[model samples]
Each structure stands twice: as C-alpha cells, then as structure tokens.
Target: MKYYVGIDIGGMTIKGIVLDPEGKALCEDVAVTGSERGGDAMCDVIAELVNNMLSKCGVKKKDIAIGVGCPGVIDSKNGVLVFSGNLNLRDYPLAARLHERLDVPVSITNDANAAALGEAKFGAGKNYKNRILVTLGTGVGGGIIIDGKLFEGYKSAGAEIGHMVIERHGDVCTCGRRGCFEAYCSATALVRRTRRQMEDNPRSAMWTKYTSETANGKTAFDFYHDDIDAKEVVDWYIKYLACGLANLANIFRPEIIMLGGGVSEQGDNLTVPVQTYVDKELFGGTSYAPVKIVKASLGSKAGAYGAAALVMKD
Candidate 1:
C-alpha cells in the first residue's frame, strides 16, 4: 500500500503523520518548529520528522509522497511558501527544498485549507461532497471543499474566510478591517464579549467562577442556563456566528459546515443555536438546500491529516 507523509507547520511545534490511501494513520509525531532559526532550519526539522515517521512505519522513501500544510500565504502551485508571519518565512521554496532532501514529490497549501481537506477526507466532512470547515480560534479560519476538492481561489490566497466582512463598520479585526467575521465570531471575540458582560453586570454568574481576566470562551456557556447575563453573552455570540455561517451557506450552499477549534467543544450548546439562526437566515430557505452545522471530529489532527490528503490520488 502506498503511504503519504503529511506535515503541519505551526509556530510552536511541527506535527507529522504517516497515512495510507484509506486514511489510516500509520505513525504520528511532532518536533519543535524552530522557525526562529529560519526557513532552512524548519525544513531540516520537517525532513527529520518525515524520516523518523518513515523509519517507524517501515515505509520506503520512494513509496511515499509528502504534503505540507503551513500557515501564511503559500504559492501551492510552485510549492513555495510566499509568506508566513508566524514562521518568519518569506518567498521560501519549502516544497522544493523538502523534495530535494527526501527525493519525493511534495505538495504544499495553506494550513486552513489543508484542515478543510482533512475533514472532507477523514473527519466530519467525509461523507459530504461539499463542505466547509470553520475554526473559531484566536481568529476565525476556514477552508472550502467544493465537489470533493479544495477550492483555493486565485493562487491559494482566496480562502481567507476570516477576513470576510459580515458586519460592515462594526468591530476592528486584526487584519485591520472593520467588522470582519473573525472580529465577531472567534473564540478571542467570545472571551472579550464575556469579559465585557461580566464587567457590566457585576452580579453575573460568570463572575462567580471567573474574573474578567479569566473569562474565556467557555465562561458564558458555563453559566448560560442559570444566569441571565451569561445567557445574553451566549445569545450575542450565537447571533454573530450564525450571521457569518449564513453568509457562507448562501454563497456555497455546502452540504455541511463543520465547526472546529476550542469553542466547538461546547458541541450541542453551540451548534444547536447557530443552526437555528443560520436556517432562519438562509437565502432561499432550508427546504431546497439545508446546511447542517456539525462539530469537527478530528480535533487537532485535521491539519496533519489534510496535509497527507494532499498527496492522495482519488
């Protein structure tokens, strides 16, 4: 059976996984990214990681192809990482360099896109022909899968869904935009809202368990059932999240939209409400085309698994 090596490069640690054509993981490992050491050093670390995985799995170099999911802008067509602020890499030919080291075919794409593909092939989106993975973390990151393939529009820079303006002139986003989806629907946004609510409502049940500084994405959810103030925060979060999801649903009309990241851990508490709002806001209504909002099953492994999927031939 042919094997594929998938590498997910992050600022802290680089995760790697070996997978078969059937999406079974043969081996999984991680190494420090050492990105501060420069792009070449990061490549060395990834090469070592691939070698270690191959050794452990008894897979020959010639029998495996390598796929990489990296943060920042990537020129996937040329296997070049155009820019990665997190990795301090720019105009780096990552795929070419790794291919030279291991003498195998290598492919690369933006990390978020890879995660979407991973879900499509092996995780939450596996059964759907069209799906999107929306990760509500520090920032809202997402990937689009259309017709069972990744849709990296216009040289792989187009899938930056977080920057989509869901609320024009509302809140400031890290991308310097006002009212972007990330500015409202991310976990960071949720924490900010939770803290603000606690500060405004001194008697909020959230304050019983967390101070303003300790308020997190789960803070409001924790007390929503019993606290009016906490429930307000949750309602606000779900409203904005549904707005963004509805915009995406109206555009792509995917079979499902999978929610990932820390906030998604709330499971039904998150999906149930957001689904209601999205269904209400759907352009042509839900009867013709329904979009199911589900939690991602792979958790942290989606990126690495998606990277491996890059090399798989259907």
Candidate 2:
C-alpha cells in the first residue's frame, strides 16, 4: 500500500492531509501559515505540518510524496512559485526545497488548478472528462480540466478565469482592470453590490437585517425572497456570473461547470439561476451538448484533495 500527502497553503492557514492510494484521507491537520515570516519560513512551516500529519497517522515518510496547492503564479514544470501576493513569495523553488528537506518527491500547482483536478478526479466532476471549476469567493478563481487532465496553460499562468473581462469598462478590478469577471461576480463583489442596494433602498426589509458593516455575500441571498432589492442584487450577480461562465463554456464546452467557495453554499439558489442564464447564452444552444452546472462536492478540502492527486497513480 502507498500513501501521499497534500497541502493547501492559504494566507492564514496551511492545511495538510495524508491519503491512502484510494484517496481516503487517513489523517489531516492544519498549521498557521506564518506568512509574515516570509517564504522560507512558510515552507518550513509547511514541512512541519506534513511531518505532523504523517506522525499523527503513524505513516512512514518513505511511503509518501508531498503535493502542494499554492496561490499565485507557479512554474509547475520548474517546481517554482513565481509570485504569490498573499504568501509573500517570489521565484521560490518550493518543490525542490521541500524535497531537499523532507526527502519526498514534491509536486506543486496553482491552488485553483489543484482544486479543479481534485473535483474532476474525486468529487463532482468524477463522471466527466472535461470540467471547469468556478469558485466565487473573495475573488473569482477557477481551473480547467480537459480529457481528465488539468490545463495550466503555458508556464502554468493561465486558467485565470476571474481576470477575464466580462463587462469591459464596467467596474474597476483589483487587478487594475475594468469589468473583470472577478470585479462583478466574486463574493466580495456580491457584498459590495448588496451594500449599495441596501443604501439605495433605506426602507427595504434588508436594512432591518443588515447594514453596510453587516452585509456579506449571503445577506442579499438570504433576503431575496422578500426583498426586491435583494432579488435584484442576486439577479445582477447571476448575470455577470453567467456571462463569465458562458465565455468559458463556449470556449471549452466542458461537460460540467462546478461552482465552489463561499457563495456556492447557496446551492440550488445559485446554480439554478446561473444555469438558466448559461443555458440561454451558451454557444450553439443547449440541445446539442448542454453543460451541467453543479456545485463542487469537496468544498474547502478540494485543494488538499487535488494536491494529493498530483502524486497519485491514476
């Protein structure tokens, strides 16, 4: 029997999991990213986290390899992290260093790409050969899978779904662009839009439940049934989300588009509406080959599960 280790590195926490050959998690644990300590310190912390997970499961290091899902531009072929604003890393040879210290073959990928692979192999996308994962969190990020393989573009810098310009010259994006998909469809965008709507409709019931400070991605969603403003906000979000998704669907025509991250917790409320729009606008109509819009089953662990898959034998 063989085992593998997967680690998902975020700004605040580093999540690690040990998995058997069949993908069952034998043990899992987390550690503070300690990102303030710089890239070297962060890698050390990740190595320690892996060791802790291995110790907890009583697994021998010889039976395992490490797979890391990191946020940022990664040179997967060279096993180097080109840049990660949140992790404060640049041009770091993450895989090589980890292997040097832990003596385990290490693989690395962009977090979104890893999550997509995880879902495609073991989660909602397991049944499909081609799939795309659209995560609506603080920002929009996604990964593409084609013929059961992850597509990381040239130099592993592609698949940046969020930065796509859906509403050209519409709204300013954090990437310093106008009308990027992420600027209008992310959870952060949802909250910002909801807050503006709430302010515009001072007498609406939404004001009773949330203020600008209390408004979040779920605020309008929770009040959608009774508040016109709330419903409008959700509608606006769905419109942009569907536009971005439609672009991907037309280009890749994936069998399924899996939604993940915080906003996806809305489940059918989010998927149903977005699917309706996607169905309407997808190229060549839905009759020939319709894309199934579904929710990501792995949730927060998708990245970890995907990381582990990097070193697993299909």
Top model number, TM-score: 1
Write down the TM-score for model 1.
0.99
* lDDT for each residue of candidate 1 in 1-314, tens digit (9 for 90 to 100): 38988999988999999997677999999999999999888889999999999999899998999889999999999999999889988999998899888899999999999899898889998889999999999899989999988999888889788999988889999999899999998999999999988999998878788999988999999998999999999999999999999999999999999999999999999999999999999998989999999999999999999999999997
Which regions of candidate 2 deviate over 4 angstroms?
Answer: none
For model 2, residues 1-314, the per-residue Cα lDDT tens digits are: 39989899988998899999788999998899998888778888988888888888899999998889999999998899999998888899999988877998999999999899888888999989999999999999989999878899889989999999998778999999999999999999999999999888898789887788999999998998998989999999999899999999999999999999999999999999899999999999999999999999999999999999988887
| Candidate 1 wrongly placed segments (more than 4 Å) | none
Give the Å error, residue 234, model 2: 0.9
State the weakest 10-residue window (summed lDDT) of model 2.
203-212
- TM-score per prediction, in order, is 0.99, 0.97
